[model samples]
Target: MSPKQRILELREQIRYHNYRYYVLDDPEISDAEFDRLMQELKALEAEHPELITPDSPTQTVGSSILEPPFTPVPHPTRMYSLGNAFSQQDIAEFEASIARFLGREGPFAYVLEYKIDGLSVNLVYEEGVLVRGLTRGDGVVGEDVTPNLLAIPDFPRRLPEAWDLEVRGEVYLPLQTFLELNARLEEEGEVPFKNPRNAAAGSLRQKDPKISARRGLRGLFYGVGRPETLGVRTQQALLERLAELGFAVEPHHRLVSGVEGVEAGYRAMLEQRRALPFEADGITVKLNELSLWDELGYTAKTPRFAIAYKFPAEERPTRVRQVVFQVGRTGRVTPVAELEPILLEGSTVSRVTLHNESYVQELGLRVGDTVLVHKAGGVIPEVLRVLTEAPRGQTPVVWPSRCPECASELVLSGKIHLCPNPLCPAKAFEAIRHYASRRAMDIQGLGEKLIEQLLASGKVRDAADLYQLKKEDLVPLERMGEKSAQNLLNQIEASKNRGLERLLFALGIPQVGESTARALARRFGHLDRILEASVEELDAVPDIAEATASAIHQALSRPEMRRFIERLRAAGMRFEAREKQKSQALEGLTFVLTGELSLPREEVARWLEAHGARVASSVSRKTHYVVAGAGAGSKLAKAQELGIPVLDEQGLRALLREKVGQEP
Candidate 1:
């Protein structure tokens, strides 16, 4: 393909996969394959620098490098990234910038979190349920990865109350899990993974969500997309609120004085780095006080109040002892280089991740070859470069042809080999697990251990069998008490109202993601209609392509699947689509809200945003309008200064009615 054509093709493929991975929780290509495509795109972008565009996948954090599987679902608000700080002066300048913007240094505390080396995920919850999980795809538009997120054990599916809000966090694999996974893969004759960060990212982007589930991925939430809604006045309180609402918050955070506190905390963290369970790239310094976040607002892509104090990427010489393939939770086999023990930074390093088959091939890695090893994020080991000279005569590293565990022939999807066996133990547990996941049927008490116990007892055959579960059946299991059993049943009963789209997604049909499910549910209105619909009718549904429609139709047509649906239907599950979304009449319009409004500002903001308005914290010249309330402050004054259109609560309500004609 020509450079331009190749870039376009790469972007198209990346986007499609992003949709599949993020929106659908059903990726088509493996991570290695996706990475290779990305590397090629990056190489081309570098060689032809003029070809680069702001919207290019190369420019976005669509999970580490290769941008979202490729869906472009807009976030309620743009999720901003952090600017970097290399030295103490950079950190000082960060505080100085905040003070300069605020015109004072009053109450400027700092909150520091180890800049986790992982993919950034945004979560949206409404009416107590987590509706969507998205990647930070260019801030405004992110790919939905909710189902994959639901696979994360600690990720809250529902909040304590019916709270409508967004939470942001870093999703990563713990170091011990990474080591164990790599060890198991190596023992099974599969290659080991080199870095935990990419492994975590790749795990989340699997076509089979079971990959994410079985991989034991974890999340540490630290951000509230709009803290204004929660009445949180500081960064530390926001985290505490997250914990109270049932989220796993990183405990390594501290709220202290500006540069000195940050430097001290960073130094302490560095001292205890090896003891931590996960990888942290740097120290994140954020203004502890949240109220001032608006006053000292954002630049184009980053906030002025926050900066990442990055650890230097240093390398050391190491010899490759052996190369091994590590099959990940999603059946993605990545290459890991076993190295002769060498000191890197301060610790002894023995293994380094080669990333993928393409990466290893690119390096032309061989046994006993010298290479430069560095810690990616100063935690995960990565082979920076191959130092060996000419070794053209050496045999190339052997790639696996079959799954290490199941011994099933691997299907080469795109540029990566994947084990397509549905019953592979590596992926089988996910079927029922996903069916009971918070995003799906939402069977609350049905955790992994319980599912394993149930499966071992042979009382449950599939997700459909979950409906057949009895209290007596559970009481006999290991730890399931009468109360636990009753609670589980109640949860299962409640899951019936999760609606058709969630059920369709939980069914694990090939190429059928949440959006497709919603499309199908909306078009058909009922499960019976969808089951009865021909491929032609299915194809005619918006966004359901000919191939995807065919796949859906065929999957639904299967006798076993029919039986599964029948059982679920018999279980009193509701199969219905919500009303089509209201028109985005306020799309492209930016609004800055100010003062204490009579109506809850959170609700008001949510309403405006739902109909497609951008609610910014700080007023800028680009702001289209300013919604001012009672006792308006400096923001109101600024709005007046800039001559931006100002509206009261009633005025805003009238504007919404005029624009959308209803409470959309």
Candidate 2:
């Protein structure tokens, strides 16, 4: 076979094996055989580079743009959180509410999916290639974590066909993996994660893709973001379609009838919940019909068509042997109770966080007190209430007046204690660590120990001084061999080109995260420009509020801070924006997509974007045109009300022809 044909065959074979191994838990080939196929594909691609595609298996690894602050992406359609149901009566009330809304009641079909106690992530695909992975941040905007998602071994990186799709699922860590991870953390002298769900979230949110890749994270994708576009009329069919597309759906998802069936399904799942591989705190009951979902509409925060029926928590009585305070990286002093170890849900619960001073005072928690402990949502250990009201010991639960590490006096920042000392050893270490983090400077071979050592030896007082280090200086440090020191130097030297966006974020500006830094860099183009701009100018950037802008202006305008910037610049670091290449032909125009069109909305959007037009999700006065399909809904009405022009598929085509002299 020709190289291209052979490459395609190899990719198909590898995808099938991947699906079998990861999704079906059944492998059709040995590890060696699979590796051989991959090796052969790589060899062919190396010889014939022109034949490579974005969705090729070789392209899946670290394919995401390594921007430090994950950009906040708005969902094409709103991701509504399900309303909760706790009891049989609540389920009955839910059914009744649906009946009341419909004005007539019968047996409406329901789909029950295991509400995996994990982080919800949205995966977006364009032309069969996975483009974005996002966290469900407030249901409307999600933080982009595409790199982390691409690291998942089983990710449906390339669909079987060139299709536009968005699917959502819970990213989870198995109970066994969670335990192993926690044990590894403890061995490494790091704080253990409270539970699997937290572990999953922490793993997925890491700046380094390697961390997420090693976490053994799994996903159970079920819901299609635009089921109407896919012609999937029911939740059951959607789940099946997701499975067919090589995306794993929760295997036990069921289709049933009535509140009684939901209750029964919940009971069945609850009975087998502990035995299941991952954490399950609840089951989601979705109204199976997609048409009815729109008809029912939504509340401000939750969907009217679906409700999560939570399983009752398993609580146990445990005594607080001692209460102690621990300082976080941000200098928040959290009170932790050292409990007399008790077994709850197969794990020993020895410590639980009091959350804040208010919670400690509310619980009236003391050194020696009986309290109810339960895994919150079958995940983090939480205190329910104190069984003993009165103080049982002389050592009372009180907020510390002084910082534990630096001995600086603590002050209240809202309800939490804050250490005002910028020079606090704990905070200093964390700051340096954050600067050298994988998503920031990405100084490889500069581990936490090396950072601590550099700080102790007074060789590098701040993160900027890192660029001033010589290979000879690192050679003297413990565990730093000649080769290792050279590699470290090379890595540090390479970090100079990380760009102004990462530098802004690395400076640890308050409220200036990845997205905020990106906006600032994209807006100002250079650090000097940002420093010259007023707070009003800073606030003009997207997502940067007035207060945040003031903070940024204050930080950048400081004489000491300007000197720091100069030092970084002297070290040959870049301070300029690297804007992405795009067509700016119709840059000022925005179009809102609604209803179904002749072709996929993504296809039209891509074409428009290539020619410099923007595709927006919502209808507003700013919208240039509303693309209405046969079933155009409220967006079209809103656009009309706002005096925005409406365009059907044919009208859109005519406009494209007139504007760009080409067919959409």
Question: Residue 548 in model 1: shift from native, Å?
Answer: 23
- Show pairs that collide, candidate 2: 69-514
Query: Candidate 2: TM-score?
Result: 0.49
| TM-score for all models, in order of appearance | 0.49, 0.49
lDDT of candidate 1?
0.74
Root-mean-square deviation of every model = 14.4, 20.3
Off by over 4 Å in 2: 1-277, 282-312, 318-323, 330-332, 356-370, 377-379, 386-403, 407-423, 428-430, 444-461, 476-484, 522-540, 550-664
Report the lDDT tens digits of candidate 2 across residue range 20-84: 54323334443334556776887899999999887776554211222325567887676766656
Please report, as a residue range, the 10-residue window in candidate 2 with the lowest summed lDDT: 60-69
Q: Which sections of candidate 1 miss by over 4 Å?
A: 1-71, 105-107, 183-194, 318-341, 350-359, 365-370, 376-380, 387-664
Clashes of each: 17, 1
